[model samples]
Target: MIEVKGLSKRFGDIRAVRDVSFSVEKGEIFGFLGPNGVGKTTSIQMMCGLLTPDSGTIMIDGKELNPDSTEVRRKIGFVPQETALYPDLSATENLRFWGGLYGLKGDALNSRVEDVLRLVELTNRADDKIATYSGGMQKRVNLAAGVLHNPSLVFMDEPTAGVDPQGRFAILNIVRELAASGKAIIYTTHYMDEAQKLCDRIAIMDLGEILGMGSFEELRDQVGKGFQIFAKGDFDGPKLAHQLRKEYEGEVLHSGRGLLAVVVADATELGRFVAAMKAQGVNADDLKIKETDLETVFLKLTGRELRD
Candidate 1:
């Protein structure tokens, strides 16, 4: 439903996004995963026509996106990272205002407001002022407003951030329902598990560029197969790390606090490493094998350095 190519943006001397490109399909959740300052927001803004890109083309439903085109802009719904609601307004009032902006009015607007309130499970608080609601409740209301017009495509940036687990779950279910109902969603979040669970395809971004793009398994395969062994017991962590590095050509990610996190190329090496550790008088109290997750793949592709 959407296509972006060679999307790049710059502010002054800083390039917030550079040659970043990806697409979202109908009824699919395309995850834009990255750390802070990785150009996720800038790219989204450009795609949503909220900001002009320095370079690249954006097409929605096969038509080239014109930021100034009201018809094109009306086809999208944006649920921003921050709540976009009036504190003094009731949830129903907020939805009415947003729907009116989308040219919704009278019975059509009222019907949509009711449907969205029910979709977000906020019907009970629809008449309550937004300021009086809890943070999670306010977030739900924000989500309701975004979908009030039932846009075919939605950009949900960190829709679940800072919400309670229940709220997060509800939001996730809503995303699934939206996709099932044939809405193409471009979802961005710092949460790896959410991306893994919801996204049909993911694009990992960093330093204003797309580092990797594919399904979870596809991205994991790019990082290669590996097993992380966590063992807790009495052991010379540094000494064992040195030995593993030499013998099996493995890397010790962590070594301290009566625990060792070792990465091995082959699973068979796990047993051998355990025996070797025992031979070195390191008695293992607990040993567990951890499969590589999205976070691991992200770190591998993006490096372990903290980003601002």
Candidate 2:
């Protein structure tokens, strides 16, 4: 339902996005994963008509997107990272106000307010002031407001950020439901697990560029399959890490805290690893094997260095 091609944006000397391109299909949840300052937000703003790109084309539902076109804007919804609702207003009041922005009024507005409230499961507290609600409840109301106009596509920017586990789970379920109802969703988050759980396709972005894009298995293949060994107990963490690095020619991904994490290129080397550890006189009370996950793929593509 959405297509972006060669999208690039720059501010002064900084390039926030560079030649980024991707698409979102109907009834699909497309995940935009990246650390801070990776252009995820900038890219979303351009796609949603909030910002104009320096170069690129954006098409929604086969029509080229024109930021000045109200008809095009009416086809999309945006759920920003921060709460967009008024804390002083009740849940129903918030929805009503947002619905009115889309030119909804009277029965049309009231019906949509009720429908969205039910969708986000906020009907029970519809009359309660937003200030009285918990963080999770407020988030639900924020989500409801975004869909009040019943747009075909939605952009959710960190919808579950700062939410507790239970609340996160609830929002994840709602995201699935949104897709099931045939709404194309573009979801952005720093959380890998949430992307793994919800997105049908993912695009990994870094330094204003799209480093990789695909389903979980497809992207994993780019980095190749690997195995991680976590061992703990009476072992010299740094020394063991150094030894493993020398033997396998692999870097130690983690060390310290009485534990060591080593990444090997091949899973078949498991037997050799045990023998080598024993030969090193390393005694371990605990050992666990971890398969490559989304986190591994992300770190591999974006590097492990901290980003602002």
Candidate 3:
């Protein structure tokens, strides 16, 4: 339901978004995976018509998103990373205020407010001031305010950041429900597991360009049979890391925490490495044998850790 072509944005010498192009079909959850300064938010801003792109086009349901066009605003709901709500206003009151922006009034607006509040599981606190809510609760209210207009597309930026596991689960479930009901959702987050669970497809970005785009399995296959192994202990990191490189004939990465993280050629090599570690008197706890996840792909493409 959303199409972007050659989307580019620049600020002086720095190109924040560079020729990024992707499409989201109806009922799809497309993950815009990237680090903090990877232009995910900038791309979303252009797509939502919040900022005019230096070039390219954003088409939604076959209609272009014109910043001056009220029609585009009617069809999109944006829930940003920050909670954009009036602290003194009650949850219900906040929804009413936003819903009115989309021309929703009287019973229609009230019903949507109630429905979204219940969906976000903030019904009991609907009448309570937002200032009294926890971080997670405030996030739920923020989300409710976005969808009160029942827009066909929603842009959610870091929706689960800083929330507890229960709150995260609740928000993810609500996202799933929205996608199942045929709403195209553009979800942005640094959490690999969350993207894996929620996105039908993903676009990994860095330095104003799209490094890769595909399903998890597809991206993993790009790195071939290489798998990562992590073992935490008071081991000789550099020595063990060298041993891994020589033994498996693949790259080995060591962290400052005396943790050995290696990329081996195959799963068989992973098993052998574990056995060798045990034989060498290394405590095998914190052992993680994982195929290339989005995080690994991010690192491989960007030449840096996701946190960096």
Backbone clashes in model 1, listed as residue pairs? none
**How are the candidates ranked when ordered by lDDT, highest leading?**
2, 1, 3
Predictions in order: lDDT:
0.86, 0.86, 0.85
Candidate 1 residue lDDT tens string, 20-48: 87888899999999888789999889988
Q: Which stretches of candidate 1 lie over 4 Å from their true place?
A: 230-243, 251-262, 265-289, 305-308
How well is each residue in 1-308 modelled by candidate 3, as lDDT tens digits?
89999999999999999999999987899998888988999999888888899999899989888968788779999999999999999999899999998999999998999899989998998999999999989998888887889889999998888999988998999999988989999999988889988899989988889999988878777665567876778877777766655445556643435677678766677778877777666775577778777777776666667872
Cα lDDT of candidate 1 equals 0.86
Clash pairs, model 3 backbone: none
Candidate 2 Cα lDDT to native: 0.86
Cα deviation at 45, candidate 2, in Å, is: 0.9
RMSD to the hidden true structure, all candidates: 3.9, 3.9, 3.4
For model 3, give the 10-residue run with minimal summed lDDT. 247-256
Q: List where candidate 2 sits over 4 angstroms from the true fold.
A: 230-246, 249-288, 305-308
Error of 3 at 305 (Å): 1.4
lDDT of 3: 0.85
